[model samples]
Target: MKDLYYIFDPLCGWCYGAGPAVTALAEHAGVRLHLLPSGLFAGEGARPMNAEFAAYAWSNDQRIERLTGQPFSERYRSEVLTNHQQMFDSGPATFALTAVALTEPLREVEALKALQHARYVDAVDITDIDSLQAILGRLCLTGAAARLARPDAQLEEANIRRIGQARQLMQQLGARGVPSFVLQVNGQSRLLPSSAAFSDPHGFLEQVLAA
Candidate 1:
């Protein structure tokens, strides 16, 4: 089986923009989809929401929408990006996904999609543990939700380890951003063309399978 590694940060607009293609890849039977949270907007990389950052994010979000046809709702713009009380952190969401990975591995990407939708479409504050837990529970992933609500040392270590491994892989590939695709076949790994993921998702999937 081929191993298709997807590197992404939950708070990244571009990663959210590439959601459809990644979701399709996860559903494909032949390839084993690995969801790696890069943690780019977590820990030390997290920042407080401010006017300048909000403006910059919205501008970039607009570009992503034009390129990928992913909607960035007005509510998200007002509630999430401009909400000064909330920090732009993916740590909690990453931890939630790690819980899902440890329990229902197949549903990791599903969790990610739901989280993205909650943030961008529904304007839910995914930076909060309560919201993330609610999301997992609503998805009927009770085990994962329970784990997230009361995290153990194993879950903490796993989340850190996953993020470390993802960062290491990014360094190895000289990749500097989220939504990166790495396809492994016969012990060989190659980076897929990033442009196709945004502009031509069908072609991107074809390229992955063909490779």
Candidate 2:
């Protein structure tokens, strides 16, 4: 058996671009996927959306779309990025994923995919708790939705711990960003090159299996 640690941030466009490869790896029988939310744009890291930031993010999003074939719709730009009322925060989404992780562990990636789609394609306000809960409900992840509706100390702690673990792993591996993949086999762990996830998803999986 192998353990694959996926370190990511829910709000990171690059991480969203890597979704297909990560989902494929999660489905593999021999791999145990542990999603660690890096809290990259959560809490104190959160920033209010401004014209300058919106332009920068849109530029980056376009590049990701071109490279990975992921859709960064105009709707997302107009609705999500241009809305200064909503802060650019991933805390709520990360917390919601934690709820899924605690309840329907196997469905956590599914939840992440759905949330990404909701924001980037469907133009939903994913930073909102109500929106997150609604998305979970649509996914038939009611248990997670319930946990999110009334967050407890356990959920909060677990979320923090997951982020802490992800950051620690990043520091240990000298990884500078999200979408970092670390493969563990035979009790040894090593960071996998993240480029293949966007450039050659099939090759990335083959490499993981071979390793």
Candidate 3:
């Protein structure tokens, strides 16, 4: 089976923008997508954001919005980003994603979609354990707390390995960002997009199939 590794963080705005493209590639290409949680903005505790940093991020977000037409809700702007107290960490969401993968391997993609929707659309605080548990319940995934607290040893190991693998894949494919695509066919890997773009998903699939 051909593999397409998608290295991304759940809270990444670019990944949110590329959602439709990722879904299209997954559904139409018959490729197995390995979702790697990069844990961007993770590990460090919440840090204070200066005015300069906030302005830069918001400006960049505007560009992303213009390019992809993905909604960045006013609530996210006013409630989450504006408040200097709340950290923009993606670790908790990434960990919850890992938990979902461990508990329901088959539903990983759907779980990711649901989680992203919950964050970007519903304005839910994905970093909160209670919110994550609520999402798990909605997905009909049981024992999420146990899974979150004590992930399978082997699965935890694999999750760590997957992060390393994703970084290596990014280097190999010369991809500079999350939401990049790489297709492996007949034991050879080919880079798609060369750069990130919301358009031309079909072109990417064509290149993959031809390769």
Candidate 4:
């Protein structure tokens, strides 16, 4: 089976922009997706955001919105972007995603969608365990909370290994940023376009399929 690895962080804005294209590619190709949770905003979780940083992120978000036509509502701005108290770390959400992957490989994409919806649409803080658990519950993933809390030794080891593998994949593909898509076939790898022309999702998927 062909493999398409999507290395991304749930909290990544560009990843959200590329969401439609990625979904189309996965569905059309019927390829197995390996969701590698890159710790883009990892570290000590939340941090105080100064005016300069806030301005930069908001401006970038505006550009993304204009480019992709993805909705970035005023509620999301007021609740998540403007609110400096909430942490922007992607670690907790990534780890929970890893846990979901360990339990059921097929559900990785679903878990990713749920996490993204929680963060972007619902304006929920995904860095918090409670918020993640609540979203998992809505998905009927009852064991997600326990798996995230006390990950089995083997699953923990696998998650760590996957993280390292994702870093190596990033290096191999020469990806410069999060939400990168790499197509590997017959032992050869190719880097798909970044967030250049996101409005044409089918065009992007064609490039991936060709790769």
Candidate 5:
């Protein structure tokens, strides 16, 4: 089996852009797709969504939309970006995804897709536990939400390990950014070119299989 790791941050605009390609890769046979949250936007990296950051994010979002045909909505622009009340933390969403993995591993990616859509499309504050839980509940993932509500030390350790491993991989590959891919086949792992993800995900899988 091939293991493909997509190192991402929940609040990253580029990661959201790579969503469709990642989904396609997830569906490929003989490939075990692992969603590795880097937590890059969590902890000390998080910031308040000020007007300056909002404008900058919107500019970058437009580029992502052009490149990947993903969405950046008016609601997201007005409601999410303009709201000074919300801090840009990836921790809650990361935990929520971790919760999904703990309760229903197969639905982890499904949870992530919903997370992205809620943030980028529906303009929801994904950094809040209540909002994330509500969205997960609507997706029929109340079990995951329940797990999220009562996260134990084990879940925290799991989140740390995931981010740590992903950071190590990024360091090894000299990749500076999120939305990076590492394809592992036959016990050997190598970095997949970033272009393969955006330009041709299926062909990228074929290339990895052939490798």
Candidate 6:
């Protein structure tokens, strides 16, 4: 079987823009798709969502929307973006995704896509554990939800390990951003351009598969 690794941060607007293309890759025969959360907006990378950051994010989000035709709701702009109470951390989302992978390995990608949609199109705040729990329940992934709500040290360690590995991979490839793709064949890994994930996922897969 072929292996494809998608490195992304759940809070990234461009990662949401890459959604459709990732879905297409998931449907390919003889290919196993893996999601690696870069945790770009997690840990030290996280910050408070003040007006300054909100304005900057919305501007960048607009560019992604135009490029990918993905929806960025007004409610998200008003409620989620403008909220300054919480930090813009991808930690919760990334940890929740790790929880899903631990229990339901096959649905990891599905869980990622669901979380992305809940944030962008549905205008929900997925940066908090409670919101993430509700999303997991809605997606009928209660196992992951339970794990998310009461995260044990094992789960926490797993999340850290995964994110660390992803960071290491990024360093190896000299990748500077999220939504990057890597194809591994016979233990040789090749980094694919991140731009194709935003604009042409199908062609991106073709190029990866061809390589």
Q: What is the alpha-carbon lDDT of model 3 when measured against the actual structure?
A: 0.71
What does candidate 4 score on TM? Answer: 0.89
Error of 6 at 116 (Å): 1.2
Model 2 C-alpha lDDT per residue in residues 1-211, reported as the tens digit of each score: 7799999999999999999998888998977889999999998989999999999999999999999999999999999899999999999999999999999999999999999999999999999999999999999999999999999999999999999999998998889898899987777778998898997778788888888
| lDDT (C-alpha) at residue 138 in model 5 | 95
Question: For residues 80-131, could you state the per-residue lDDT of candidate 5 as single tens digits?
Answer: 9999889988999998998888788888888899999999999999999999
Best by lDDT: 2
Please list the C-alpha lDDT of all candidates, in the order they appear.
Answer: 0.91, 0.94, 0.71, 0.75, 0.87, 0.88
Count backbone clashes in candidate 3.
Answer: 0
Candidate 4, residue 83: Cα displacement in angstroms equals 2.6
Task: Put down candidate 4 lDDT per residue, 1-211, tens digits, no spaces.
Answer: 5578888878788888878876776676456667886666766433555566667877887888899877666676677777777666777887788778877767777778777777667878888888888888788777766798676887667767777777788888778888887778888877777654277887876666565
* lDDT tens digits, residue span 1-211, model 3: 5687777888777887777767766776467877887665666633555666667767777777787777777776665666676567777777777777777766777778888888766778777777887888888877654676666776567667766777788888787777766777778876666233465555666555555
Pairs with backbone N, CA or C atoms under 3 Å apart (clashes), candidate 6: none
Record all residue pairs in model 4 with backbone atoms less than 3 Å apart, i.e. clashing. Answer: none
Off by over 4 Å in 6: none
Model 6 collision count = 0
Candidate 6 scores a C-alpha RMSD against the true structure in Å of 1.1
Ranking of predictions according to lDDT: 2, 1, 6, 5, 4, 3
Task: Give the winner by TM-score: 2 or 6.
Answer: 2
Model 5 has an lDDT value of 0.87
Indicate the worst ten consecutive residues by lDDT in candidate 4: 43-52
Model 2 TM-score is: 0.98
- Which should have the higher TM-score, number 2 or number 3? 2
Worst 10 residues of 2 by lDDT: 182-191
Question: lDDT tens string, model 6, 94-157?
Answer: 9999999899978888888888888877878888899999988988899999999899998999
The count of residue-pair clashes in candidate 5 stands at 0
